[model samples]
Target: MKRLPLEGIRVADLTMVWAGPFATKILAEMGAEVIKVESPQAWDLVRTLIPMPGVEEFWNCSYYFNDYNRDKKSVTLHLADPRGRELFLRLVERSDVVIENYRADVLDKLGLGYEVLRERKRDIILVSMAGFGKTGPEREYVGYGPIIEQMAGLASLTGYGDDGVPYKTGISYGDPVAGAAAAGAVALALIRRQRTGEGAFIDLAQREVMATLIGEAFVRASLRGEVPPHRGNRDERYAPQGVYRCFGEDRWVAISVRSDEEWRRLAQAIGRPDLASLTLPERKARHDELDRAIEAWTEQIRPQVAAQVLQAVGVPAAPVIDTEAIHDDPNLVAREFWVTLPHPRMKPWRQPRSPWRLAEANPTPRRHAPLFGEHNTEILGGLLGLSQEEIAELEAAGIVGRAPVDARPGG
Candidate 1:
């Protein structure tokens, strides 16, 4: 295999939940050695977010945790303990990057801030992904992805115009967006270190990253003093654009007419040839009536069939695939976008391949997410040159463990 871009890089991952794990996963895909450090007393919450009923080691078997955490090693360490902190700093002395998404105060409180890390390894890159940045007034506030969306103004732009209400996206939209940005930031930081031999402190605010998505909305508010009105799925540039229900239960197809020519084609495709000559203004005026007519035709066909017929006539259309149907999507299947890796505790299931396709390097997932403390010996003994007796002593003292200290049903 060709050498991946981040080959030979070592990262100490001090993140949990979606955003941090998602960022580390991208780095791991690019060939970084990501050691996920979790304290035995306080492990990643996602491990037990949806525990499998009556299953042994349910934390290790969580599909939610396994999906985002593949291609990384797990190391249990109680950072609050002096020995664990010493070991972590020793690990940091040999690592290229240290990343965490704790609140702005947590790292300093743990005595592992960038200044302390730089003392151990002067050229180490520290990427802090706090919900708000370290210097902001809101830096002390805690926030998740949904809260980030609302604070970033994304929620304000996401409702139907008629409802006078705002809606957050169905998924935790801010998380992956910030994760992708943080991964890119890490790459850039590495490049800077190579060029200037200087370390960097990247203070990334997740809310700021989410706000970047609505740049046009900010421009409108600033330049025209206009708040962006919600149009739901409708685009201002396109008329008669909406997602309509199809024949199957809960199945829908999204259709858009960008031009008069496409509108003509769409009208003909929907068997409303009489409406083909309507101009853009006329179409805009009658979008509701057109939607009703389009639905009258669409409700008789399956979403896929409706998408195909409309697409055949050059009107932009696609089926709004739900969670289950997405796994069977033909386009994704043809592109080999999913892979099913063997897991020790769970049956093989399709997981998404890295979307960052490097034609030559061909990054692929090498292993499943590690079981708790799976790499404690490999890292502490093999890398740090600790003796077996020393490791056993640490484990006995509750500085490291094979499982959480007080495991419960819900994490």
Candidate 2:
């Protein structure tokens, strides 16, 4: 097998829930040794967030936790405990990166701030991903992905024009966006350290990352004193662009006519050659009428067929596939977009492959997510050279263990 880009790098991962875990997962896929640290008394909330009713060891069997946390080692540590903090510092001495997504004040309050980590390892890269950055007025505020989107102005631009209300995304949109950015940030920090031989403290604000996604709105707000109006699926630059209902219940297809030529093709494809001669301005003016016309043709056809027919005629179109249907999508399947990895606690289920495709050194999932504290002995004893007697004492003291102490959802 070819060596991956991140091979030989070791990361001390303190991230929990979605964003931090998502970032570390990407690093792990690229062959980094990611040691996921959790406290026996205070484990990652996602572990038991959605408990399996009849399952034993519910924390070890959460599909949500397992899916995002694959290809990493889990180590239990109570950072508040003096001995646990000392052991964590020892681990950091051998690590390349340390990352977390706690609220801005949490890490510093725990006394493991960047300055303290720098004291232990001079060239260690520390990444802090708070919903708001560490030094801002909003730093004290706590939030999850949905709240981040609303505060970032995305939800403001999401609702249908007819409705006087904003809408959140179907998923936790901000989490993965921040996660991808954090991965890139870690890579850049590593590159900088290689040249300058100095570590970096990356304070990544999730709300700021979310705002970067809709930069054009900020430009409009500044240059013209305008706020982006909610237009649903309609684009300001393209006419006759909308998601139309198709033949089946709750099925839809998105179509966009970028140019007058594409509009002409779309018009002719739906047997409206008279409308085909319309210019961009005319199409823009009659967008509602054009949507009705397009829907009339699409209502009788399946979404996939409508998309195919329009795409064949040189019009931009695709079916709006739902969550379950996306796993079986023909195009995605052809591209080998999913992989089924073996998990000890559960049956093999198809999970998404990384979208970052490096043609030469292709990355693949190496292992299932580690069970809680699965690597305590391997990491503490093998890496830190702690004696077996010391390891047993730590386990007895609740500094390291396989199961969270009194673990419960949202506790």
Candidate 3:
């Protein structure tokens, strides 16, 4: 088999929920061995967030969990316990990278901070993703994706102009954005390590990274003490840009008329040739009117068909694809965005493969998520040189186990 870019990398992933797991998923897709350590005492909350009615191993069956956790091994360990700490450190000593998304204080409190991990293995790269940074004033504030959006000023920038209130995205958009950057951070740290033979401690703030996307807004803030005005989907640079509703149930098309030529092309395409020669400034001044005009034409057509019509005439347009529709999108399918893998406990569903498609070294998912501690004997005994009796002793001592005792989905 042709080796992938990250084929030799091993990561001890202690992240739960979206941000951390999303990053590890990318690494796994790029051909890294990811050991996901969880605990019976307080497992990943997402495992039980939406449990199926009577499924026994609901944790292993979650679409959300499995989506991000594919191609990794799950190992249950209580890090608060001394034995768990010792075992985790043992794993860390052998791991090339360690990732966590716990609160700023959690890792150090667990006695597994970057300094301590570096002591165990001098060149161990550590990526810590807190909502804020470890040393910021906002570090202690509890933040999920929505909170991150608000804190990062993204929410303030998203809303219909008529409404004074800001609107949050329908989904937790911050998680995946931060996750993608974290994956890149891990790769950069590895590259730096290759040059210097030293490890890096990456302090990634979720809100800060989310804020970086709007750097021009920061310049506006500093130069003129300006806060961005909410223009809904409209951009300051592009006039007559918005998402318009189409014929079907909640279907919409996003259109951006960048130049006078695009506006004329779109106008002609939509049979509004009388309004074809409107300049950018004129379009900007009458954006809402233009939106209504566009929607009038679009409401009679399917979003996909409308987008294609606009695109055929050189307008930048696309359908606002929803979850189910996106899975069936021909472009994404042509790009091979989705994949299905068999799992022993669950039937196959569409899961997104990594977007980082390396042409020469194409990485593919090798296995479903490992059954809880499925490689205990192989990893602890074979890799760590523990004798069979010693392994038995460790299991007997509550140092390791396949499943969590008294484990409910989240419990």
Candidate closest to the true structure, highest lDDT:
1
By summed lDDT, which 10 consecutive residues of candidate 1 come out lowest? 402-411
For residues 136-166, could you state the per-residue lDDT of candidate 1 as single tens digits?
6999987799999999999999999998699
RMSD of each: 1.0, 1.5, 2.1
Ranking by TM-score: 1, 2, 3
Cα lDDT listed for each candidate: 0.93, 0.92, 0.85
Cα lDDT tens digits, model 3, 1-411, are 367888889999999889999999999988888888887666777766665557887766667677778899877677988878988899998899999999999999999998899899999999999999888688876568998888888887888768678999898888999999999999999999999999999999999989998788888999999888888788999989989999989999999988888899999988899989889888889987888899999999999899888888889999998888889988889988888889887888887776666778777666776666777777777666678898677677666776565666644
Model 3 ranges off by over 4 Å? 387-398, 405-411
For candidate 3, the lDDT comes to 0.85
lDDT for each residue of candidate 2 in 235-329, tens digit (9 for 90 to 100): 99999899999999899999999998999899999988889899988988999999999999999999999999999989999999988999999
Candidate 2 displacement at residue 162 in angstroms = 2.0
All candidates' TM-scores? 0.98, 0.96, 0.93
Q: Which stretches of candidate 1 lie over 4 Å from their true place?
A: none
Best by TM-score: 1
